[model samples]
Target: MDKPKRRNTETDPWSGLKMYTAARIALGRTGTSVPLKESFAFKMAHAHARDAVYSSLNLEVLLQGLHAFNLPVHVLHSMASDRMEYLQRPDLGRMLNQASSEQLKEEGSSSTEIAFVLADGLSATAVNEHAIPLLQLLVPALRQAGFTLAPLTVAEQARVAIADEIGELLHAKLSIIMIGERPGLSSPDSLGVYFTYAPKPGLTDEARNCISNIRPEGLPYSLAAEKILYLIQEAMRKKLTGVKLKDGIGLLQG
Candidate 1:
């Protein structure tokens, strides 16, 4: 019997296409099957995605990292007590536990211009790695923009909506939730920022603006910070965000 022909990946017409993006594309073949190396790579990517989802945020590391910014920080938890419950009950993840709410209330009712919430969303790996660095950039920028910041809030088992609850409890005019985005095969450690102006409980998704795919290999830190700062500036001037307010990419040109 003749052996099957293996397509030389180096000479495959489609191999060069991979240079354009991180997407899985242009895989070479062996006879009628995908190349063994490609199959192994796919499985590896899948493992990373799964691991990102189940990973727990290192609370001590996160807290210590936040302290480096010299800002007051508070820890909070969602009603969903565990990762299993967080995944199974998203609604619970979007609300603070009773203790967390009271803790925010005790901190005072002053209306801060912005509140930052670091949340362990779908990809804890993303949050654990990227949140502090992003916050380091964002906090200083917001201060320079004349926005008063609330004490930093670190939330566990949290969803984007949890930022609204924290903002409302802290009497903040805006809420920025830095969370781990849903991991994709090629991008397991992507973080996301969801900004909501005039955040309050029960506000719908249409009331927020999101900047996603924030990682070293995805959206670089400086660009992400610029975009976020742009949104915050626009949100303040327009007194709104979400569907009505556009990203104003053109504003970046000048």
Candidate 2:
């Protein structure tokens, strides 16, 4: 007996393109707006995106994941007391809380070659979901490269600039902060990585290098690690980062 043919429910000409990207594209329409199911899907996606932004990190869980690597982990807080303040006052999120500063000081003022920081940026969900897995691959690779690692620092209510203060406090030659990126309509769990060389408080955006959109569907962990490791080696060699330093991943691959 012959089997019946399967019919394609997505009739839009551009529907095939959906396979290429996560972007909301070629959504089938009814009159002016999308079909009821598609419209409802859009609403659900928006809710997920919003939830990712407002969510708080479970620091204990993150600590447990980091501890599995057998590395020293320290918890720190930004000056922002809560998520509300963190959203409203970005500058506060860029500085460590007084107690956190004291804690870092007590950990000792000895300089290290490099420090790794993890932070809950605009999307705590992203950090909770993706940061540790990337670190699982990155930390060992960094060690194999002969980099002396400092105690890993986990910062709550943090901004990318917070790494500068943490790096300065630890006297690290370089600091890499893995943080949650702002959620998009489709990418609620995308993570970001930022690096600063000889980080300090007054440094501008031009002083750091960023690799963004890291997730399973975005930049895969292994490739992101390779790019980051390449950048760090170059940053150390040139004693620079940010605009002046080029991401040599392509060149290295070539």
Candidate 3:
């Protein structure tokens, strides 16, 4: 038996072409067999797994970021080192403790047209990433538009309902609370803002206007700021917000 002839460029012009074709087929470019190792689905799954680990909120980092803003901070419940404690005790998260409430009452402004508050609702990463920038953009815009701003507050262990509590604490005609929205795989650092006109206890979500997903991939800061200011103006003009304000006034009109 004779050995198969070795093909080379010197021997045959088609040798390189044959080698290339064989390599391509071996790499599954011909689609005879699925390339499980290099498949897009496999790469995507690996990417998602990495993101799940890295995108998780670091509350300590988040707190440091908020502190950099030089805003007043208050905790609603006893500080717990455990994340589960903070998540499980939502009742503790809803209202400021007596000491915090007193301090808020003593230190916070009593009268203002609008008050701004930040809360780590679910994704503390949201506050660190989106909340501060959004608030910074909004506050100056509101002031430029002749809206008065109360002292800003950072509420720990706070929920959405705590906006009403902070509103009542500051006695503000309108209150805007920026919170970390529940994280999804697509948006781990999403920020949401809820604005309540004439905010007080017993108010529901229906009693406030909300702007969600304020991260870079969502609404831009300048646009979000403009929309918030416009909504505040509209709420003042109509004396209502949330569900009561018909015609969807001040909502991102073309």
- TM-scores for candidates 1 onward, in order: 0.93, 0.93, 0.70
**Candidate 2 positional error at 109, Å:** 4.4
lDDT of 1 by residue, 1-254 (tens): 99999876568676788898999777867899889999999999999999999988899999999998776899999999899999999999999999999898899867788888998899989998898888889888888888898889999999999999999988888899999999999999999999999999999999999999999999998889999999998898899989998987766696
Question: Stretches of candidate 1 above 4 Å error?
Answer: 1-10
lDDT of 2 by residue, 1-254 (tens): 98998887657677789999988888777888888998898899999889988888888889999898786789999999999999999999999999999988888857788889999898989899899889888888888999888888999999999999999888899989999899998898899999999998989899999999999999999999889989999999999999999986797679
Please report the TM-score between candidate 2 and the true structure. Answer: 0.93
Residue 14, candidate 2: Cα error in Å is: 2.0
Instruction: List the pairs of residues colliding in candidate 3.
Output: none
Clashing pairs in 2: none
In model 1, where is the ten-residue run with the lowest total lDDT? 7-16
Kindly report which residue stretches of model 2 are placed more than 4 angstroms away from their true locations once superposed: 1-11
